[model samples]
Target: MTGPTLLADLVDTSQRVGEHAGRRTKIARLADFLRRLSPEEIDIGVSYLAGVTRQGRSGIGYALIRDAQPAANVEVSELTLAEVDATLDQIAGASGRGSIADRTRLLSALFARATTREQEFLARLLLGELRQGALEGLMIEAVAAAADLPAANVRRAAMIAGGIASVASLALAEGAAGLSRFAIALFQPLAPMLAQPADDITDAMARIPMAALEWKLDGARVQVHKSGDDVRVYTRTGNDVTAAAPEIVSAVLRAQAQSLILDGEAIALKPNGAPYAFQDTMRRFGRMLDIEVMRATMPLSVFFFDCLHRDESDLVSTPAATRFEAMTAALPSELLIPRLVTSETSAAQAFYDDALGRGHEGVMVKALDAPYEPGARSATWLKVKRIHTLDLVVLAAEW
Candidate 1:
């Protein structure tokens, strides 16, 4: 009903857990509420939801509208405290879009009639940290509670609404429970695993755990799924990217294996078959490029290490050696994953030494008996980087 309450509701509806239809219904409701509020009250609401600039500017209303338009090309960046204060001042004094008796009036009119991108920009300007925070969630809950609707129902309904504003509208009418009822889909078996910082070969080698080690190549982490002639390639984020790298996808399609998921590094290779820098491979990712130029500039070679799906069964729970065997059988190239046949730590160390001599990053020490955990960066498959450093602790205390 109020500006702050409306803003909060919009945020709640944007939560990924809700149903799309419900969220849309909520958005429509919020829009109706905005229509009832006076321009001045709306400005006050914007300022309250997102702190007003020192100059009294509340860009939240304008931002919200701008964000909804396809033609609205807006770039948001981090702002300093001083910048926030200045914008507030400028907004408070400026009058153009509508009759402005005050900052609140101006903001209300801006949001009420502005484009989607404008509204999005304004909301970000108001909320500060527009990417992630409690504002979106809290607003939804506040709105739902205000309307005396079961928050859970609203949240479920919100999934249909989609977008930040739609969810917010639901929250205004239904409350926090509405946002909570929706199921959030992560969609992938793997999350984005962070690479431990490895400056050089020695540093990577030292980090290697006491387990079976394979050379770590400089490449992009790729998950390849093959079911007969069909193939799927997923990046670390689980986004399907088979079309981006058709050659690699086709290679997986041609594999003799049926229904297998192989996790490995996809590297750009030189003409003589040497892998290029990691940056080179990154250039080809998610780009519309000429195939001939792409092949010439960034030829890729996927080095398989772990197998998840194998032979009509998910072999992720199987032992590392078993999975390795399956991976080896699925492809003919030794370059897939050059493994060593030695239980001895010294032998593994020797292999690591040899791999580095071939310009590899380092070795990944995997427990031979372990299962393939997609996203886990456990010590079971410890990554060893070759870097030299001492963990030196400060002897004295600092303020």
Candidate 2:
């Protein structure tokens, strides 16, 4: 029988993946490494290569990591991937009283067994600084290449599976046939389809002359899942916020469908129906404590724009118009967002103006016949704003 895979092997593969410039070269190296991993190691190995830990954040920050580092690294590599993963599992499960010291002890013990290079990799992985360019997109390509399946097939499976690691595990194990098992289920949140920013309404209309335009409110994006009376809400990043948004849950429970997954925005509205600031909506959406007080003081309203699943049918690959029709049939008109489908640029411009006049951020121009591409900034969907906005990352900030 083959012995357990070494952490050094994964670290070496990650180094090679980072050193390569071409995407094909990166995918080739990643695919080779993925093929060599045993069945039990695929999920953990894939997540690490994709720049995340399987255990998620382990409460080990920079200070704690620094304090936990050994005075000297091990002379030789001895740690296996399973061993490292087990250590992280323990660290993540450590909580409540004496958790910090327990975490520090676990970190120290793990680091003490790792060599110099392995120590660097572990520190970076723990601190979320693992920027080797092996992001989810490239990893998806690698998984496809490794599994000998089309990239689109793997991507679609990843969309429904919520992450590439789990999809990779299945694809590598059972190939295309295993992927067929993935389907939209209640409470399992899929990544929200993203939109590319258009220069203006005219630009958007030019690209998609016949489009479905909906007001883009300055609010929190929420995906609600319901089965019978059980309802759950997830944020854009798939964090469960059901407990924080009881009003949203109650509203979803009242919907006509027995099982449904609806994507929309949640905004805190004034008594007269004007939306509060984005931060205010987020404050209510992100809160876990004093929810009743917050809900009473600043109530949130939801407006559905797309339906992904209804009862036993999966509508992810359904045309936008059909999905909208399904949403309309299942939800009250007040629960759906205001939308207008038209080919005329003049009508589209008027709708855009009205959305801005109502204090929304802008409008989304989506192709009526196009299917939703989850987690993708698809050209089929474009966002038009009155003023162009640029997002910047601060390298250095001085007061």
Best by lDDT: 2
The window of 10 residues in a row where model 1 has the poorest summed lDDT is 45-54
| Alpha carbon lDDT of each predicted model | 0.55, 0.91
Please, what are the lDDT tens digits per residue for candidate 1 over residues 1-399? Answer: 422233334334333322344544544444344444343333333233322322322333443333433433324423322333344565655667652434554444445443454456455656553532223333344345445665555433443232223444434433555455433222233442234444433443445433456778877788777767778777875778777787787677766676777788788777776667778778776555586578667767777787766776667568878888787887867437777655555677688888777778777766678765433445465566676679898897522
Error of 1 at 172 (Å): 22
Number of the predicted model whose TM-score against the real structure is largest: 2
Q: After aligning candidate 2 to the native by TM-score, how far in Å is the CA of 42 from where it should be?
A: 0.8
lDDT value for candidate 2?
Answer: 0.91
TM-score of each: 0.50, 0.86
